[model samples]
Every structure is written in structure tokens, then in C-alpha cells.
Target: MLILAALLASAAPVPVASHERLSVIANGEKVGSVDAVRDHDHVAIHYDVKNNGRGPTMDETIELGADGLPQRWTLDGKATFGGDVHERLVRDGGTARWTDAMGARTAPARGTALYIGQSASPWALGLYARALLKAPGATLPALPGGRLRLDPLGPATIGGVDYRAFAISGIDLSPDLILLDKDDALFAVLDTGGATVREGHEGEVPALAALATRLTAQRYAALQQRFAHRIDAPVRIRNVRVFDPVTGTRGDPVSVVFADGRITGIQPPDAVASPGEASIDGAGGTLMPGLHDMHAHVSLESALLYLAAGVTSVRDMGNDNAFLPDLVRRIAAGEVAGPRITANGFLEGRSPYSARLGIVADSEAAALDAVRWYAARGYGQVKIYNSMNPAWVPAITREAHRLGMTVTGHIPAFTNADAMIAAGYDEVTHVNQLMLGWVLDPKEDTRTPLRLTAMKRTATLDLATPRVQRTIDRMAAAHIAHDPTAVTLELLMGGRDGAANPAVADYIGHLPIGLQRRRRQAIAPIAGPADAAAYDGAMAKVKQVLKLLHDRGIRLLPGTDDQTGLSVHRELQIYAEAGIPVPEVLRLATLAPEQYMGHDQQLGSIARGKLADFILLPGDPTRDLRELHRIAMVVKDGTLYFPSDIYPAFGVTPFAAAPKLTLPKAMPKAAGAGPAHDAMDEF
Candidate 1:
């Protein structure tokens, strides 16, 4: 009986070998593929592996062939197997043995004899026969080429073949085929690891098991279309009141279109829209190119606030490089909303403060290299701060200009504005730069002598003098733009009283608490009596300097060196206070800086092809400058944002009107009500 059983097992009709499909997946997503074969007790799976965004995969496969036999095997997709597999297997036991293609077997002498076959083995034959008798007909869902479908979770029978169903959830491989016998035991599982298994099919295990005999496949081309929109298309605005700051013209209602990120047309309101065009109603609001804060720190939140204020562009005079690139990228990608930014990186000088801001280049070579470093990084310009030696100016300027960057800075001590200008500084900041030419002693020590000398020296270099006129002429001729942050100086020099200026109150409540604290600290020490006269003298000098610059026909751009957010508007107000007409003051904030930066073509005005950066106010600012404080809406790059959304970023509260205070005018007739001197002293 033993001999007969052995012969029958050896001669049993073996099943044919056929290719089995396999899938590989990662993180529950299909990513690779393979072909496999299965035997009764074991299966060998051959698979073509490919990596999808995940790491490499190791998988195995098994399947039944057309000859009704099963084959199975393991596959290490990484192909890292080495050494003697047969030896290792032989050392284990008779139950586990490995053989090479040359028929060399590695196994330890053991109790059971090993049987291996390419077709269905004796164990497989028994299982197959049982499956055939139990199952007759079954089918599986069709799978696309290069894809695999996971068997659903549940009991199933295919062609009389019974399968014990259990889902392999979160399998990071695509499945190509599945196999089971009458015992419902899984014999083979083939997968590519790169196929996706959809949900809601757990109840279809029986159906999938029935079709396991046939291979199903699918192709994955990564679903590339996800929330992507082109921002390059032109946007048009119609029936808008256009403000052309360049020509000082407020044109009638017009239609403007901006495409390819530039203004392409400015036609009458009746113009027709071209193909692929989008239009927005202007609602009779004034349309002007975006405004700019000539000086601003480039904080992410602050940048957004600037945009929310209708500032389409800004010149970041100071910021760390570590954050600039990301900010630039975010702005360009239309991610977080903000205006186009032009960064200067940081100005190099010799003071402690300068070092904190940027490199402190004390020598000519260091200065030259500093300029080159910034220019190389694509900074729009180089700023020279207060402690630079006057001797380093020429080399720094030449190097910067050579690298296609502009040089602008504060006048060094002992150097007048004109001297710095003559030495190649393209621009000078603050009217203080020109103080040397007007001060009697050109020193900070005693205001009495300087004030007396300034008053007496009017004949020598009075702002109206020919020499002063020549200096101004030279600046204009050189196209040097001046950014007099007069408001900052006024606040700094006006002995703390300027902090309470009504204009500042409008935005002071919005300042970040930290900044507000710091600002108070900065001005607190200067508020006392000993320094009072000095502060007053400084304020007087700032005013005189601003007036002188304007009278000389030198271009003036408004900037606020004050607390970043609260000061921009304050600067505009100061410009108005500095004798610049209201309209002109608005122009300085809106267009002058753009022209100074050579960005006028795309940025300075609101017309066709320009960015949609403008503010909407209840009343025209030109008619009543104070109306600027009432920002109704701000449009930046075609997106509208409210000031309320921005104020908190700066730690400021929106402007709230205070109740009006009234006093009795007839009180002066009552002498006993208060002594005039006492009242005057109290005031």
C-alpha cells in the first residue's frame, strides 16, 4: 500500500504552470507589479517591480495554472538575497529546504523527504480535486491593465473552489491575482504593490474569489488634476475712475485689462472683452496703481497687512535673508496674499545697530564686497547706514552700480549730503543728511550757537541760496531720489508730544503690543526736560530740511521709519503737514516711490495691464486727505481684503471715532472762573 501510494503521488496528473499577477502598494496606495505561480503547498511569484513615491517593497505571489496545478514562491523585490540558500535551509530541517537551478539541494538530514514540483504537487492535486467538485462557475470584477484589485473580505467560492476570505487592509501593494482551494486556504497572492484598492467592496470577496483564475490589471497615471488654476490670465476692470499719478490725471470712467501680469489695454468703458477674459465692476471707485511703503520690515503678517491696505508693492529696506526667500515664494505662488516685494536685504555700516541689521563693513574692500554680496543675491538695492566711513563711499557705490544695483544711504558724520552725493551715493535719506550745509557749527552739542549761526548763515548757504539750488539741481540731474522719513524724525524729535499726534491715534491702536511697548520705551527717555530743547531743535531742523528739499525740485518719496504698521499712514499725514499739498502727498505715497525704483511701467498707476492694487474710500482722498484714513476696501492682486482682517496682525484696533468734546466759548467773560496765567500754565 505504501509503494502504491508513493507511485500515485509521483504520477498524479500535474497542473500546468501559468503566470500569476501581483501588485505592490505603499501606505495603502498601489505602487508596483509582478507575475507569480503557485504549487499545492508553496508558490513562486516572479514580479516586475517599480517604485512609485515610496520606498522599495518586498512581496510574494502564488497562483494556479491552466493545468489545474498550483505554484508558489517568495520574491525579494530588492534582490538582496545572497549566500547559500540551500545550505541555510538544510541546516534548518527537512520541512524547509532550498534548491538551486542546478539541482543542488541544501537541507539537513531530517524525518520527511522533500518534494518539489513546477506544476501541481500531490498536496495541490488533492486540494484542486476537492475545489473542482465543490465549485463550478465563478467570475471576478474586471481590472484594467497595469492595475490590480484587492479581494473583498468574506467567504467565497470560485469554479467550485472555496476560499476563506479575510481582507489585508492597508497593504501597501497592488494585487494582481488571488488563489485558494476547497479548504478555503490561501495558496497564492500576486501583487504589483502599485495598484490602488478602493473601499466599499468588502462584501464582494466571493465574487473576487470566483474570478481569481483570471488576471485583472489596471494602469495608474497619477490623478494629476487637483485644484490647480492659472493666475496668469488677464483681469479687466470696467467703469472705473482711473487715477494716473504720473500725469496727475483723474480720467473718466474707463476699462482696463491686465494680462500676462501687465497692463495690456486701457480703453473706454464700452470696450469689448477679448477671448478668455474676466471682468470686474469698479463700482465707480477710484482705480489707481497699488501704493507702496518705501520703508517697511518684511514680516509675513506685515506684508499681508500692507497688501490689505491696498499697497501693491513695498520696498523692504531691512529684513533677514533667512525669511526673505520663503516670503518671496509665497507671494509669487499666490499662496498667502501680499504685494510684490522688492527687498534690499540690509544696509551695511559700522554701528552696533548696523551690525545687528547686517554686515558691518568698516573698510573699502568690505564695503565693496558687501554691495556685491547683496547684488549677487538679487537685492533691488544697497543701503548704506549711519556709521560708514566717508572714504568707503566711492568704492561701495562703484561696485554696487557695476553689479546693476543702486546705492543709497545716510550721510556719514562730517560728510554733508552733497559730499556723499558727489562720492557716488545715489540717494540720501532724511533731511538730516543736508543739515551739515545749514547748521552753523554742523555739530550736535549746542543748539544755541548752531541755531544762531544757522539763522545768520542764511546768506552763505540758505536753502534759497544759489549754492543750495545748485546742489538740488545736481540731485535732480543725477536722478537721485530722496526718501525723507519726515514723520519718523518728527516723532523722534518732537519730544514725545508727536506720539499723541491725532493722525497717529488712527493707527496706534493697531500696533502690536510688543512693538507699542518698544516704541514707548524708545521715546520715553527723550520725553524729559533736560533733552527737551534738543528735541525741539531737532524737530525744527527736520521741518526746515523737508521744506528745503521740496523747494529745490528734488524728488521726494514718503517713508515711515516709525513703527512699521502705524507709521506708513502717519508718514503720509506728515507729508501733508510738511507743505506738500494733499494730492501731492498722496502721490508721494502712491507713485513717487515706484518711479524711484524704476518700476513705474508696471506698478505706478491704475490702468490696463497693471496689478489690481487700489483702495476704496467713502470719499475721495484728493478732495479731503483725511478720507484716506477711512479705508472701505482694499484690492490687492485682484483679491479684496478688509482692514479688520489686517489690523489684528499689527496688534492694532480699527479706528473708532471718539465722542466730540465741546467747551463753552462764553467762559472767557468770567474772570473769577480761572486766572489767565494759571490756565496758561496748565495748558
Candidate 2:
């Protein structure tokens, strides 16, 4: 029996011999070959795989072994296989097992297995197959066996791990996945695909790759230097119109002194203090602590725009890439000027698209890993997105709080805002989340169980309703902050009609050409009969939800979910249109966000010891709120930037003369019997 078993195992497979050349064929088609080479303990079969066939070869697998040992194997097209290959293997090993259907086993000197697959997307499959043929065993999840030759691209820190980046051509990988073992073997690859691969190259792959490597390395080094610096510098601003956002009062012109980046004094106009100190004349313009756009995209350009718009601070609710620490460093060191930015690097979920930008945690273990990942990277909070399983929320929140990181995000599809808060969500976005909790039926897609029950009980919730007030009271008691992003909601609701509001029209000229073109194209499809009614109704619902949240006294912070730089100002205007008092609306943009971000003492007001981040407008914005559009100058951390300089950064040509402002005309009276239409009368 033992001899027969041995024969069966031996006949089962044979390892390739040293110096032996072998060809690999699947169904009579030549696919790859191996070049044999010998080392001390083992013989290495270096293989070359190629795919020249018109269609993607299917039901193919490579069986590998050494000497008489049966080595389990896998075939990966791109080094980073998409989908849940690992999980699939764990769940059902037989699904990926290699087997021959026909006959009794006959061992050959080398073994082979059939890979079963049908191309889903032909072009993508062809590319993947071609890559695999070019680099057989290259897709093997193991370290490279030789010293890697990398063109130094730059320095970068990914997921808090610092690395000197080197550009490697002909491979798609993220810098974070590149790894080198101690044996001088390249163990992993970083694929930067899509437009990002060609960002700096002017369309040349090699040149772009080299530039990417160098830029990444430089960025890493700069970040390290920035992190090393302790922020203890004293700052001062003089001759500014100080606005007390909390009190809705404009204080007398003053000179504010700051030490160690904290407000030290707020004095009358003529206070004389230290010599050789930085002083901003404020150009006789309004000065307040930097404005905060609570919801923003923290790109370098966006950061600059935020500053240009007099936004000294921002809270990035979501972002991809594990580069938050570096972004924070750049902003802090003034290396790349912008706001005092706080970021939630990514949300956690279980979808493919979500995995790319969020932490993919299908289990409690994975969820815990995600929390630690953000905490170690210096993220102040975690923003959860849709599709997250409610079961994971409590564990995620517990782990995050243990690490001192707050949790916030959209209430998941099946969960209501109340459940999310009870699960330890520090803040809720979008008033729609709350409204859905009250009126939606559980059986409908929009209804959550919490909402259905509340509605069945005839629960009336407004800023003052007991249920709504209780929720707010609990949040306040817990020191949890809210970011309503009322302006974004308004735009989504009111601006969907064919007619553009004044605020929207003003922004149209300022938008980047590319974005504007895209928007124009996008609107065309929605404007047609088939989609118009649905779009209009959806927008009206959004507005109704916002009014409900406001009537309930829920704390509202100004946030523009659009481009972070210019949209924030537009958001404030939208808030005014939503019936928020102009002064209160301005406060939401200025002091409110600062308080939510826990930087009230150092930001959100123009006082001694506060960071000098403010904008100068031609008129008082609190009076008309529209005055915000008249941006004369922007001061960020004591640095003055003129409108001319800021507009160019936005890819807009600053008009030598501001465009004539004319309100949209109402539909003409029937037969023109009434007074002649006045376009300027709308505002």
C-alpha cells in the first residue's frame, strides 16, 4: 500500500530539471516556456509566458512543484489582482483548485493546472493576460529574487511608512504596495494607473514615471522636515476690522498679538508691542479668524483656493490615499499654503470601489485594523460611507475612540442617524439622514426601521420637538459636533431647475473650464423630458429636509461638497437663501466650523493670539451676505494675497472690470401689458 501511494505521488508530478528548457501549452496552443537554472538546494525554472491568441485563453492553470514536492500555486494576471481573490480562496478553496477532468493521473517531469475563466470585459482581460505572459511568476505573491533597479522618483510617506520612491515602468501599482525584502529582492510593486500616471510627464510614460518617482521622494523628505518642526512661532495682525462671530458684533479696529500660535492680546488700534513683528494692515478690510469649510477636498490646489477665499481652515470629510499626515505637515509648515486642515483619510466599507478609497472591512477584525490604520496615521476622525454593515459600527467606533479618533460619516443605507449616533457617531452629515428617520416607511428603500417606527408613532421632530431636541441635547452633552452642510443641500435642491440662481451664475464664470464643460454636458441629459420631473422632485425634497433640520435647532456648519476653494463662499450664500439669518449664516462659515473642529480658541475669530486667517471684502458680508462675493483680498496666516493672484490660481482670468451683475428676469407678463420687465429687480 505504501509503495503504491509513493508511486501515485511520484507519478502525480515532476519538477523541472536544472538547465532543462520546457514549453507550456494549453489545448495545443503554446503559451509559455521555462529556462532551467540551478542553485544549491533547488533548481529554479525561470518561465516566459505569452498570450498571442485573439481571445483570452480560458480553463488554464500552471502547476508548479520542486523535486518530488507538490507546491501549491496561483496565477495572478496583474500583481495586484482585483476583486476578492484572497477571500474567495479562504471561503471555497475548490473554486480555485486546479484539476484535469479526463483521465487517470500520469506524472510528467513538470506539472500544469488549468485556469478556468471567461473574459468579462475583453479589453481589460486582454491587457491583464498580456501582462501575465510578459511576466510569469511576476504575479506570484513573493519577493523578487534579485536586486531591483529603480529610477528614483521622489520621497513619500504612505500609510505612515516613509519610503524613497523609484519609478518602475511597465507596471501598475500604488507606491504604498511597493516593498523590498532584506535580501535585495523586490517583493512588491506600486501601480499608479489612470491619469495620475501621466500627471507630470506631458504624456510620456517613461518621463512621467521618472518624474513621479522624484516628486514622491521630494514630497516625503519635505514632509519629514515639516513634521520635525514644533509650531511655536508668535504671530500678530494690525489695523483690521474684527468681527465677533459669536456676538454678531463688529469690534473696533485692533492689533491682535499671538505667541506660540495662540491669541495673546486683542488691543485698540494704536497698541504698540514688539519690533520686527509681522503685521498685516488688513488693508482696512474685515479680519476674522480663518473661515472653515467643514467639508472639503484637501488637494494642494483646493487648499490654495481655500486660502485665497479667506478660508484659513477646513475639515476634509473624506479622501483617498494614505497621505493625510503629509498633507497636514505641508499646510502647517507653510510649505504648501492653505488652511489648518483636518482630514478623515477614508471611510470603511465592503465594496470594490469603496476598498480603493475606504477601508474594506467585511469582518470585525478588518474593521479594527482600519481604525488602527487611521489612528496611527494621525487622522483626527473616520468618515463612514454607505454600504457599511451596521454590525461593524459599534466595534469600529469603540476601536476609534480608544485611539482618540472621533467617528463621523453618512448614515449607512439601512441604518438611521439615531442608531448611528447611539453607535458612537460623533457627528452626522446631511439633514436628509434625520428626516428619513422620521417619515420614511421601513419597507421602502428610503425607510429605515427607526424612521418607520417614529412615523408610526406620529413623532413630530423639529429643532424644538422633544425627540429632536433630545437627540441634539445628547450630542451637545457628549460634545459631539454637527456639520449640516446646508449650502450643499440648497444647491442640490434649488439649482437643479433650468434657471440658474444668481449665486450659481456667479460661480459659473469662475469654475475651471474642464469642470464647467463637464457640467454643461451633464445637465443636458437631465434636462430632457424623461428625467426632468424626477430631478426636480428630488431637489425639492432635499430643500424640505434642510428646512426641517434648521427648524429643530440642530447645529449647522457651512460646508460645500463641491470644490473646496470657491464653493465654500457659495455655500454661505445658499445658507442665507435657506432662511438662516445672514449674521448666523456668516457665523456658520466662520466661527461655527472652528468650534466643531475644536480650534475655537485659536481660530474662528479676530482676536489677540488667534491665527491671522481672514478675508477682506468690499462691503460687510453680515449685512447682505452677498457681500462675500466682493472679495478684495485674502489673508492666510498673516500672508496677504490679492484677488488678482487668487483668481488665476482658480484657472480663471480675473476681469479687469468685474462682470456686470444683473438679476434674472421673471417670465414676462402676458402680452407685455404690465410694466416692462426689470432683470435687476429679482435680487
| lDDT (CA) per prediction | 0.50, 0.49
Q: Global lDDT for candidate 1?
A: 0.50
* Candidate 1 lDDT score at position 298: 64
Alpha carbon lDDT at 529, candidate 1:
62
lDDT by residue for model 1 (1-683), tens: 23432443454445544444534432232334544454553455443333211122334433432222222233333221111111112223223343322233443322222222211111222233323222212211110001112334444454354554322211111222344444444443422211211123223333442233123211111100111112334556667677767666567888776655456788889988775454555656566666677766664445555654556677777655545666677667655556677888465555432323555676778777778778888886888765677778888888888888887766665556777788897777766555545553435421111222232223233456675676777787887778877666555444242244333555544554323322332232232464555555555555665666777677887766532444667777766666777767778878788778887765677765566567655446666656666564556655445565455433355542211111222222221112322111211
Q: Which regions of candidate 2 deviate over 4 angstroms?
A: 1-239, 255-267, 270-284, 352-355, 436-481, 490-503, 519-544, 654-683
RMSD of each: 28.8, 20.0
Candidate No. with top TM-score: 2
Give the C-alpha miss distance for residue 522 in model 1, angstroms: 7.8
> Best candidate per lDDT, number?
1
Estimate the TM-score of every prediction. 0.54, 0.57
